[model samples]
Target: MTADHTPGRVTGADGPAPVPAHGPVRAVGVLVPARDERDHVEACLDAALTALARLPPEIVTALCLVVDRSGDGTGAVARRAVAAHGHTRTTVDVIANAAPLRIGEVRNLGARTLLRRLHPVAPERTWLLSTDADSTVGPDWAVRHLHLADAGVDAVAGGIELDGPGRLGADPDPSGCARPPVPDLYAANLGVRAAPFGEVGGFPAVVSGEEHALLDLLRRAGHRLVTGADIVVRTSARTQGRAAGGLADLLRERAAERPVTAVEVPAADGG
Candidate 1:
């Protein structure tokens, strides 16, 4: 939300808009939703760009950063990243001040916009990958998803290793002991075909259950989803201050949806 002094689309009565970073991105459309993430945005973008760079230019579409009405520098940082790649075929741009479009709403908008803009020929085949701005995906992240898709699965879930403020403390709470096996679709490393996602009506609007809800819908619709540790990404352990309760909340939430358990969270590396 920092005064968008660049050059592009003006909101309501705003005179002129910053000329948005030029984009008609053609690769995998990576959509990231961020709020107050100034501290971690750089490394996060680094990982995303690195992964995007590894893809064939024709295969890698555009990386879209959705700024969620944050007063912080998240959007500004995203703009700069896109600017550096703007002069080329791959482009990145900020879809500014989309506040009312909280978490899932903004995410849906970002993915759908890129799907329409970049893949005008066949949006259904276009791949849209979603991740939190604070998460860092591995070098082969995009490739793995593409490979997974090529293998006939409609969706592929990736792995997440906790880091930063999310790491567990030493002398861990005994309740935090059991480590549950990773599931098939962690939001941090999620990827899907654009058509199925659109068909499912995007993610649930509810903040906490949106990702889970989407998975439920996909499963119910008979779309196959496979979770793999090879598709690794690291995530923040903090869940809006619910980290102390550990996986307890996750278990409680999932239990209502299906059978659940208290899987322990291993201490994050470098902890």
Candidate 2:
């Protein structure tokens, strides 16, 4: 395997050490992991490029796409999209891995590649943002996270909304009215500084629940995690998902459990 494609050693979650305060975000890295997402990859890249355009020309930005075990031409599609609509301030890196790796491992690979591309910039001064190939970020997505980082927040956990057919409903009450679902922490909308991320040993190597695991480490280490109410990303609502225990799987389970018409599906709010 080439050096860039080779998997790096994962940092262990050795007991909680004091995480240093971070400085303003001088560089931003957007890590996207895709597997058989040919249809959604272009739109995802477009949305990200638009968001980067909104940032100042001086802020160095990198969009690293790690395509893992995709039968479809997701990697090629991403390259075409970036070549057509890529921003001047943003550099795009597309890495393809045919090995059958889970989403978390693919994400870890993307983070390591991005960090390498943004070298010389201290990890604390760099902001690492993550999103799935099936998700499209808002125009202010990067701005909102960067603002929090500038204010000394170590991480930002944003919310997500399903875009297509299936509507997700929370547990019903005695009155059979489904309560308004609370904003959730979604990997589709998460941001963290490169320093604390490395300190917490990056993401766990699981297919699912890696986001929760990484966040738990941050919390235990006393790192600040600000909920970005204004930073919600729109994710695909298709039932056939790539990850084994992902949103699509949850949607399928919910559908199997109850009648869709019986429960009121919340218009927004999905993890």
Candidate 3:
């Protein structure tokens, strides 16, 4: 929403304000796509900022909140957080998603915009993490990412553990994770290599299947997708409420079609 003019960095003719270029930056850009998410936006930003605090300010250069046009004050909340956080070195960008596109479209738009200003190799050494505005990162989320990167893994598919007593939609399922016909691989906790994410073109503008689609591309390219105890993020069932028809029935409706086109993405190399 603001033009970047931070010292040591050139402001884009039309991009969010740039972070103060105290030194060179590298790492994944956390891209959050939201729509009218004021309900949990503040907590989300706080958690994200907290996670970043674990590392040096120079590493996590920015937080890109892609806010779709909403009558609800989601955008306003994002702006407030940016101001409150003292965006000294951490650049906060508010992108509008007023266009009538689907989930994949939003991520693609954001990833492309952010990638232009980000360090290409950082994602491999860094993570381009994505989460909805209704989600929050774990206490050690960022730290874990750095750890995984140090271990030389390219893609980390971490899952979110819902906050206890989440919205009506997040009831615990005794049925178990495997019982669900279509398991969700949400980007909320997905940490992927930046170069691979870009090489695969990030997310596509589709009604669904964004994460799986991107994963498919990455796997085919022979990147390693590792699961880790680290890199966890807490997500609200409210954002994925559509599956169950309302906030109250979300978890129960886990069985559904894959959001991304499900093709055989070859197994990633363990290397």
Candidate 4:
């Protein structure tokens, strides 16, 4: 899947553009965990809302933005963005976590809220899509997930590209270049089947690497996972980020050092 860097459009490889799925989408929910993201939340939501608007009118789409102990106007900015672009058919809920919660917990909270709102819908039909506040989704993000679900994939580990200068020294090629794959699972761009996600106990409570942890859980459970480049998201390159030991930290460390042989970073399991 080639990413069209154009702000709102994303096209898949060698085919006609994918149309939104027909029939009610059991229930589609986007889970975003944010903290002090006042500068980037609007653009993030703008890109998300545009992708969602293309879904069939009957699909019950919702955006669950969990503001995790934000000191700034993150929640306010998110609410305003939703009001401006969220469709009447879509439900937009902004839930605040008064105390600081780890990334995993924040995402779990958003998922739970979405589950409650979409309770009547069967879990098998429900889809939970996650992205970070600092990232803007491509136009076909949701559409690609739906297509994968239709093709019987239980979860999707989508790819991401650094949006700015900070990048890990190990990164082999420039953004959008074809290259060998690694365990690049990230919450910045991931989607899951609600039933399997619930079965795996959702995201584990971790300070970081929660996305990979969830991927491991799904893999252990024998779910069909699709790791693809078709649904790449553009994420932040800031070194100082909301979570410690995260992508931001790695980027910062790499930027500080000269390019060297990429070290084998251990997975969350310490493998």
Candidate 5:
């Protein structure tokens, strides 16, 4: 079997090269975690692959999907999507986690697997991006993240706009027009350098709020973080999600006011 589909941790000679002190980002590894998300995995992979293609051909880019205890054949569906795209510029791989795991653990697993696959490329110069199976990113998402990294941004927190059909909470205004959402850090839209991510021990193995936890850790460790307002990701509005207290739960918190509409979130101040 190829190393990409191989199980277990990558290390020693088979692992990536030593850390580089400073340089342009030569590689980007994207991680997507799914649990019983057969319906959403295809669109997720499509969006991720398309975004990866937007980057210059010289930059090594890859997408790794971590399917955790999914009985719905999410892994198989993702593989088919990758094959259908047949994208030459980016390598796509899927890992099946038979054991039950939290979203944070799944994300970490996908991150490590992708990072190792990008061997001989120093982790310090690799950008690790995170998204979800129920979300879709625009073609410019990867490019925007790379531009920020190139500008010395160690990590990026992106905004999200609700898509499809569901609303988040009750309209506080009750003026018939929905109030704009207060932007918060979401795993569906996040990016970080592999070095700092590893230094902070990666993401915490929690059910939800892993993204916020990781960013907070990075901040405490003195890393440069910025909000990529242009890197907005469109996430699901199902009102039911993989993790507790996640975006879906937020949306389901209140009864649907009207048909789901795109939520406009205010850009948060940069850290």
Candidate 6:
């Protein structure tokens, strides 16, 4: 079902009692933005819900699926996926943005919605985990973020593994050549502390590179940002994507190369 801005507790057929805003550790809000993602949305939600189910009993979680100008059945498919997974404690919110929104705008919409539902002090304890509709995370995704948060980390830039047939023969360095380091701040596997994220005005309204922009904002503010190779996510390798200059564009460029091995340069700021 679609979500509204109601003030009362949210409940579903198989959902547990409403979780209070106050708790030992703050809650987690997983935000996903999609457009015409009917082919991948269900699988993405399934993987996310599975990972979230592993959180501690005291840590509440919410899944916010923002369907932006989707002419297909993406929203309905996502709702059904949530129902099938049946996590009794995780609340699900489906937002329908009738007008087309940039990827950054859609992410901001979901984050703002979660922010409004959170307690004033919750930001310090809360975490915002973001991923894409074309990606599937590991089972320990939420647990990894929780661990980082407990360690006083302000943000996390996770790694990604490209998958699908499109990636089969698209090796950029076929000659086994070495290439310069590439940045790995993709939104498909990013986590942020609620406080710093909100303080930096969330994500910009740009259609691409918003993840890197947000990371730069957090770094400029002196937030503790870390990169976790263990928290890698599997994302689609298709050349066509929802937004221009996105992962699809990168994949297309890589496919045209002669295949090379590129090393990841650790962030100068340590994260």
TM-score attained by model 1: 0.71
Ranked by TM-score, the better of candidates 5 and 6 is: 5
TM-score of 3: 0.72
Assess the local accuracy of residue 179 in candidate 1 as a C-alpha lDDT between 0 and 100.
Answer: 53
Give a tens-digit lDDT track for model 4, residues 105-176.
Answer: 889999999999887888888899999999999888888777766555667777677776654424455676
What overall lDDT goes with each candidate model? Answer: 0.61, 0.77, 0.60, 0.76, 0.78, 0.75
Query: Which pairs in model 4 have colliding backbones?
Result: none
Worst 10 residues of 4 by lDDT: 2-11
Candidate 5: which pairs clash?
A: none
RMSD to the true structure for each prediction, in A, is 14.0, 8.5, 11.9, 7.9, 9.3, 10.6
Candidate 5 Cα misplacement greater than 4 A, ranges: 1-21, 165-183, 256-262, 266-271
> Candidate 4: what lDDT?
0.76
**Tens digits of per-residue lDDT for model 2 on 103-206?**
67788999999999898899989999999899999998888777766756677777677785565656786799887663356788889989989998899888
Q: Which candidate, 1 or 3, has the higher lDDT? A: 1
Give stretches of model 6 more than 4 Å off: 1-24, 165-180, 259-271
> TM-scores of the models, in the given order?
0.71, 0.84, 0.72, 0.81, 0.83, 0.81
lDDT of 6 by residue, 167-203 (tens): 3223245678756545666899998889889899999
Error of 5 at 150 (Å): 0.7
Of candidate 1, the 10-residue stretch with the lowest lDDT total is 1-10
Q: Superpose all Cα atoms of candidate 3 onto the true structure and report the RMSD in Å to 1 decimal.
A: 11.9
Q: What is the lDDT of candidate 5?
A: 0.78
Q: For model 5, how does the per-residue alpha-carbon lDDT over 134-174 read when each residue is reduced to its tens digit?
A: 99999888888777666566777777777765554346676
Question: Of models 1 and 5, which has the larger lDDT?
Answer: 5
